[model samples]
Target: KVALQFEEDWKERVYDRRYVALAHGELPKSQGTVSSYLKDDSHYVTHSSQEDNGGKFAVTHYKKLKSGNGYSLVELQLETGRKNQIRVHLQDLGCPVVGDLKYGDGSDPIGRLGLHAYKLCFKHPVTGEDLKFTSDIPKAFSAVVEAI
Candidate 1:
């Protein structure tokens, strides 16, 4: 994992494209996107000496890509690397990642957690070199999104 930074600078970008299991209502088609700081919860805990005052902040940006009968494909950019940040944020959004047993309704539509990292960009700390890597969205992901 990349070095965790709590600042909101967003210098390190981790973009994920995932399928979410929607409930009774679907995401607003016209809204296009949503972003906010993730509220602190027990899921953010880590092996550290710092006290848990519930002030730790995490930001996530979401863009709806497609809507199916009971699911939606979304692109998410995490500004903070808190543990389970994406899952927790999506859970709070009311439509958790599909197949996420800990956060969602545990609907295993894809037979696994519907989260995938498609891109990662960060500056090397010591060399100050810009580093970036990207991968194709999984075929299973595309199959699910296309069904929308």
Candidate 2:
């Protein structure tokens, strides 16, 4: 996954995290590696923030949810330009993009990730209409909203 940290230049860093099921109790003694530590592993999977954290999922735009379920903000301009980049990234972090059981949270109540691309504000590519649109948080996100 590709993520940019908060610092000078804001150079983006990319990691290739994948699903590796541990054999029985083989989970890492440390929840994650030091590299992931610098990237905030524990909460990275959740829809929260990466304000000084270090872990695998470093790209911050739509962070893990930190509190009562409500909505999530997503900026797709940085999409890795790959199929399932977002879903793969979030799943790698352990927090499958909510309703996307194929990625992170498989225990979906309604269906789909508890996340959404709630806002889309930009100027028309040609018309320059300063178009802006927003979508309500998916109801699936609400059923487990309080979990976060």
Candidate 3:
């Protein structure tokens, strides 16, 4: 027999999301934060410069883990989730994620988006205990990091 349980208000719980991205060019700093008001603009999201416009505030912190062969491995923590926040913010920093043609340099070395969600942390809904999950980086990502 098996049972499943969930918190009464689990949908409102907060979570931490971390991802690794292979980006083009070197980041300006080893680590930093990107904050912006993002709004949906058709196929993608864009920074909203106007205060009166409707947009969601997004923030992310990124660190350079490795760089070589015209590519840099960036580790990112999402403070606020907005559509395409990582891709847009990275592009704003002038280092788009490799293989992210819509929001990057348009190079598809691995034939897929160069972004991977490596970690997620949150409170367990039913038990109210801290829960953290991590996934191994895909071989493609590791290969790019090693190659560069």
lDDT leader: 3
CA RMSD for every model?
6.6, 12.8, 3.3
- Which parts of model 3 are misplaced by more than 4 Å? 1-12, 43-45, 48-53
- TM-scores for every predicted model: 0.66, 0.44, 0.84
lDDT of 2 by residue, 14-81 (tens): 12222212111111122332111122234443332334443233332232222234323222233222
How do the residues 43-140 of candidate 3 rate in per-residue lDDT, one tens digit apiece?
56475442535788888899999887777889999888777999988998888998986788798778899999999877766576888899987788
Model 1 residue 110 distance off true place after TM-score fit, in angstroms: 1.0
lDDT of prediction 3: 0.81
Please give the CA lDDT of all the candidate structures.
0.58, 0.36, 0.81
- lDDT-better candidate, 2 vs 3: 3
lDDT of 2 at 90: 43
lDDT of each residue in 119-140, candidate 1, tens digit only: 7665665465666777766666
Clashes (backbone N, CA, C under 3 Å), per candidate, total 0, 23, 1
